[model samples]
Target: MTLIKKEGPSQMDVVTATASVSDQDSTKDVSPATKDSHTSPADPTEAGLRLYDHGGMVLVPTPTSDPKDPLNLAVWHKCMIIFLVGSYSAFSVLGTSGLSAVYPSLIQAYPNESPARISDLLTYPTLFMGIGNLFSMPLCVTVGRRPVFLFSLLMLIVTGFWCAFSDSLGSHVAGRSFFSMAAGQSEALAPYIVEEVHFLHERSTKLSWFIGVQTVGTAAMFVATTYIVPSMGIKWWYLIITFVNVALLLLSYLFVVETKYERVEATDGAIVHLNFAEADDSRDSESGAVRNGLRLRPDIHGPRTWQHDLRLFHFKPVWSETFTFYKDTFKSLAIPSILWLLLLNGAFLGIYVYQASTFAQVLMSPPYLFKFAYLGWVQLVQILDCVLLVPVLGYGTDLLAKVMCRWRKGVFQPEYRLISMSIPGIAAVIGCVIYGQAAAHPTQWSWMGVVAPYHLGYFAFLGANLVSITYAIDSFPRKAGPVLLVICAGRGFISFGLSYSTVPLISKTGYDGAMNIFAIISGVLAGIAVPMYFLGTRFRLWAMQRLWPKLNQ
Candidate 1:
């Protein structure tokens, strides 16, 4: 009777008892500890990997598994990363634009200097901006991003203060050299942005915003200093900018967390998601307890004191290390995407540096009849440029990816990103022509309508350059930084040559011829995208097949 009662049941009772037995079996087969240890197999389709610490805590590792991660960025911890990576972009533009307003004052302070000599003060910083990267590229990657950024910032801050008070060309040149030393930060920024962000899908948009903000910061400094110099005097302008930079330094100290992470999966800096205290507690008895509470310390660059850090200047016989770095820096030249990057960046940078120098001279001085501050108001168009591009640039690139993904039956290709370059490329050429022609024939044209094209072209320029860089980085996934470094070096050289010579180029060619030349060159090259779109697919496939093996080896 007892057996019958125990065995007997309505169908429901039988099902319930069987389920209870199965649950017991499952519990016995997989202990809670075992269940906690295993990740529910990742979707292989996703590119990133899962990271687990000692306490059964999981983190999404950076984008790669190798000793070096692409960007090693994390989700939800980007503000600091953006700030740190972005610091260089800010420095680059500020150094260039700030001096434009102060040139006359600089001339007054250092009389007996030719306009060309004064311009050297302006030009050399950019020259160094590019040259400094020559050294920083290999060093940053070999040493680390944080150390280079810190050292650069320190050099910039100290030298900048000295520059504000200096009365001689030699001292100013020394200040500018330090300014150049810090310039590598900008070259490093793009890779940092791409590496530490969400994914290939999200990189373009983020990069666009980063570039756009940098433009605003750069443009505003020019516009601001234009007025401030007149009222506050040049020394005050320098002092004010230096003080603003001090704020930037403080921000870096406080919020800009170290990006270098231990777990290969840690993509962003200072993993905010993990509860450090709780993680420590959970793994207190574990053999790998050290890994649980792994917050990165500030001195990740080894225990080099400030004096030792400065002594890098004296660290000789470093030829072996230096040679290795230069070898890596040159790696980008071998990639075709680098050519596109070099062309696009060099063109854009040249036009911008040239225009910034000449436009004020051409417009404010003669036929346009505007004063410096009023000329500053001309930058209002830049406002429109940013207004139009900011919301769309990143998202537009992503949209291009989606459209391309569909075209390929749901497979994504690097070539798809190239399509976004066309509109901007054409816009750039047209802008150069308008800006040049209008300045040449001021009597024949209204300055307002003429200036409109230049600003409009800038919008497209930003979009296209953003497209070019993002695509190149994505396409050459393994060598993004090295590629950008080469591109930047080329751009630096271009910027240096054009900035110094633009006055001469414009004087020799006249505004009409100069603009026409740039227009034609850019227009002809703009067609590169059409072929790029058509042939780009085959090229990328061919390159990927040919290069990845070489790159890996």
Candidate 2:
């Protein structure tokens, strides 16, 4: 069952294989039109149906005639969902780094506290954030996305207020930790949400927006807190974020809907059954309307009512699925490709955190006694790296994939995405070296000289992040949630550990020694992309044949 392009007025078409008599007999209570749609085909033994149209670039995820399927939703609806999720991710990262900008004030507020102890404000929250994924991932899989999102936002609001009002160091630590645990859902689940709603072509660009907003939010908060902390005091940071959280929470309640659906693949001439009865009836009524068109099915499932979407509880969690989540996570770690991605994502993030954690301490002392406000300006390099690099790499990689697909006669390999990583991989190494050298002799070089490497290194890091995750999703679309959860958890924990030890590590080794050591680690990890580009396809095929079968069992 192949997907051949038909020269119709519309560019898109649905190609479903005809169902068997047994299927129709089983669903006898279904409507006649639906029954006819599911009736047996002439040849019933055909396998390996085409699921995507490379010539027309259409998804073949077997979206029901139902408008409720995320793949079949209206453009406006898709954009709204994307915007809300992106905002949620941005705010999550913002909260993670909110305290970093005001460390000076935190130190003064608790005069007896050591620098490392104060840094716990950032460290503990980040650690809990990673741990949160274990619970959030399973809950999302069982209950649904909407409830998890609403609950997470509520927790953030409550915790943000707690942090704002708290005076004691212990209270602050507890509040931040709980707040991070809630916010961790955004990191673990947002990419999965993007995958649920968007198609293969749309995934990379939208994910870029999602992750780009996260980085921007982190950098922007530093800039905003610099001013807010000095005049309004450190407590105001939480108050501001709390207010923003509340507004976003309301928006989420109104706009976001459950995106979970079981999509089946059908080939040309196959009879596909519609999931929703209302959608089937509506499609049946539109006899003259062409089914094979670029337009999606109109919303026959009816209006997006608040009552329907606001359901707090849905499915019960099975303990077996929870066990599978853990088992799959550990089992995946053994795969060479998955292991490489874990290292790639974790090392870059750990190195980035190391730089961020120590940046203020190193710059605020000796030859470069940068004021708090000026310290915020130093993060502009990272902001620039994300803003400029994310779009280029995201859309560029997609374009590269399309070009390669065309060249290879419409056979798209996941390894094609890795080709774009070569430039960034080399850049990361160079950036790390320059950043290390500049830190060693701050007076010898200007501030720009010191920061240039950091920017370059991060640019490469961001690109690698986009490519690696997209590749993973492409390789294992069904297990995207667990795959991404593991990456987020691994990186988050690595970054947390590095953040915790940054002060002491630098104290012992000096700025040059710490930076160069991390640089070497990052260089080796990023350099792995070269071999991955050439051999990644073979690795993916090997895993699918050997590793996937046992894991599935």
Candidate 3:
């Protein structure tokens, strides 16, 4: 039950040595193979292979001797990889939403086109961002994280240049769609990479940081592009995006190593093995070599070095495994608890997009009369929400889980995270009510009043999103990657549809009526968490016991 460095002999040498001893000690006249078979099962400790133990705390999925194992890598190295991938994810989003500020200039350039056509520049890209996940997720799962990410970045850079120079509407839309498709990996794969490198205790906080950077990128782009478009031109704005992508691509090539590792949980359920080596009596392999698991190899030949990481370019897809992955992803939707979580995330995104699409139109008319240049400043509220509220919600939930675990005699349950959702859920309901009512009387309340609810609503909405995603991942760690793909694609598509219908819905229902309707929907969705909080553990247990087996089949 203690971690010890076995540097003198390879793992196979130890296994052979143990086999010889077991054969001599056997009561019956059994062969060496027979003795190993009997001892391996009887001992239950894998013949003294050390279990990672630190001060009575066992490392789940015990790290291998291999320095390239992400868990075994130096803490600084892990942080550097996380930072690099996170930056790539954030910049992808920045590119996706950056053009929102330049719509006016685009309209002038294509005078024959309707405003709606110009709007497609943004809408099409958003739609493709989600669609791209279908392809990106499979590629990342099969080939490798580094190669897929590099490919996506290359597409992003090329499409960015195409968008910057294209003169025709047709060409622009095409370029933007391709650009978004490439950027989609940021949403689909970034969280998966985080999970691959970090432990259970570190997941929620790390994921929060990743999600936060994405929001920052989206918000920062609006502010930067807003100024760039008015001061320079739309082309210059895209050029800036292109330049940033080039820089990120270079960083990714040099530093971002492969994170995919074959992790196996211990059968006794006491620990997890990050790199397991199955015993083979037929061959006397090297000390660190194992036939069935990731063998302990030098960092230079494994994931740690650029030369080894370049192997990601070799595309190899196991068709049956890929098919099974897709099947399981779809099957996961049948679980009600998971379905509800996805809906909650999608509802928040729908509301966010609806508000973003309408806020400019509402403020520009009548009493406030804010100019287009100033409209981009509205995102500052969202930026503040991310900065102040995200840490409180992210780390706050992690702390809550830890405290609850201590109270429960050091046993952690995924349900502990749901308790923190109540506050944000209620806040969202109130924010929606205020925003809905304020939009009805823009002139009377002034733009400030209308915007106040927005700040509150978005803050609460994002908090709920962060908590729910973390909860889902914790509840189903093995399936989290594909599940996240479903969430990302589902929410994006839903948001696109909601955004498209916003103006028509508002015109038909009037701003107050529409907002009220949306408020009711938001409240109902957020309120689902109340019952879930009280009864979620039972549901999770039920799924594990009943639903999971069925889904696997």
Candidate 4:
């Protein structure tokens, strides 16, 4: 904001500057969508005026007028899209950890392989899952959201069949790896949908749904497969999942609209000071309010039709843009805020991933000698955790962000959301400690004990992520586009790296010792948040000013 000397304007010039957007185009919406907002400023200083969105509050990723822009879509319509995406996200996790139910059978099936090696079936696929997430970004940008989603579902279907009939352990592992690769897109791509379609006011809540539904799906799959594998066998589990993919593919094709939008006019998301008047019915963010966007008038394009949604391909393939977007997807990893959030989310997810990968191995061995059929009961407890924590962690943080924003006079501070991290951060450490203690002293704690905390560890994992992701995006709304990729990809790569070590780590350190390590790490990470809450703003600002320009170009 370089200041310039200027001649004084007359009262007439002032009146002209303050005229409503309607003065220019009656047919257009109250808000003009362009790189430059033509609407009057929200605040007038002695020298000039400051502009804003959302009745003088700056809307993040400023709203646009294009009928197809997801931000401008009807509330119910956007909800339906998120609902479908959430469902897709939930089921996607089944491909990652669902096979935990059959770990014993896999051991026998792969007699020549070590138990540690067999764990590769679960561990290694996570790397491929990250790869899949990375792949989805460029495709979703270059191709279309619907095509990428439909294509990933296709991958799941094909790879699922490949896993079901695989005779050798190597083949089965490969199939699982590929199966997860397809499913992993839900982690990256779904969050992008949530970010693009929802407002800053509600973004956290939507992101929590992304986390919560997926966690529930993970637990649900474990429960179902444990029961299924015992009676119908492992192949049936694969077949059932395949059938699920087929149904999901069909549902997606019908309901998942292409979200790749090139605005007829641009509404860049940026905050600015402005003076504007609020109207009586402005509370209605939906419908014909410019707050969201004045809908296409009945005289204009009217409501979007089902025919538009059901269509698959929205754009021609642009290989050049694909490569560019592919690089852009990874660029956020360099931002200090992005890297911090990645570490935070990864730390929390690690506790859950480790628990998930190791649970069957621990319970089915000497101490309890539990049968595979009983693992479902363990997952049920995690399902309970999922149900209990979603409201507390997801919606809770969203409410906090809203309250804090109002306190700051609509100037949102992303750091305020980290207050939600306390409960989960504490829970993460406590859960690790208690779960570790139980694992070490099984004779005292018993098999009944370890699984409960082990299952519930996922609650802490997802809860922390819910806070980290929402805050990270809020901290840098301009870069929110890439937060999905960085956080999800980092989680994938981090979790994958942890896989090779989890089994051996427990073996060397003993159960309690391994958990002690995680407990300390989690506690340390949690402690870092206190400083982050204070300094995070500075770091993000510095990165945006110093680093963003270079990376973006």
Residue-level lDDT tens digits of model 3 in 1-553: 1222122221111111111112222111112221221112122222222222111222333444354566654455567776777777777876777666566777777899998888898787778999998888877777777888888888988998998899899999999999999988876687777766765555667777776776767677777777888788778888888898899888778767777766432221122212122221112234443211224445434534546654555446665766766776786687666778778777777776777667777777887888887777887566777675556777777778767655643445566777877766666666666666667787567677667667777776677666776777766665666677777777778888887888899889877787777777777877787777656656654554464544322
Clashing pairs in 3: 10-287, 11-287, 61-272, 61-273, 62-272
**How do the predictions measure up, each by TM-score?**
0.74, 0.83, 0.81, 0.83
Summarize candidate 4's per-residue lDDT along 1-553 as a digit string, tens digits. 1111122221101111111224332222233233233222132111111223344533444444445556666666666777767777776777667766677777777789998788788787778888887778777877877888888889889988998899888898888888888888877777777767776666777777666666667667878877787678778888988897788788778766776666323222233322234311122333444434232343364555687778788688888977666565566676666677788778777888877776766777777888777877777677677666667876787678666655544445677788888887788887788788877776677775677677557778777767776776666554554667788877889978886788789889987898889888888878787887777766664565455554322
Poorest lDDT segment (10 consecutive residues) of candidate 4? 10-19
- lDDT of the structure predicted as candidate 1: 0.57
Instruction: Tell how far residue 198 is off in model 2, in angstroms.
Output: 0.8
Q: List the residue pairs that clash in candidate 4.
A: 42-274, 42-275, 43-274, 43-275, 61-269, 62-269
The superposed Cα distance between candidate 2 and the true structure at residue 498, in angstroms, equals 2.0
lDDT score at residue 223, model 4, on the 0-100 scale: 80
> 1 or 2: which has the higher lDDT?
2
For 409-512, candidate 2 gives per-residue lDDT tens digits of 44456677878777677776776666767777787866665667766767776777778788888766656667777788888888777776777887798777
Listed per candidate, the RMSD to the true structure in angstroms reads 12.1, 8.0, 9.3, 6.4
C-alpha lDDT of all candidate models, in order: 0.57, 0.67, 0.65, 0.67
Deviating ranges (above 4 Å) for candidate 2: 1-54, 60-62, 266-307, 310-316, 550-553
- Whichever of 1 and 3 has more lDDT, that candidate is 3
**Model 1, TM vs. native:** 0.74
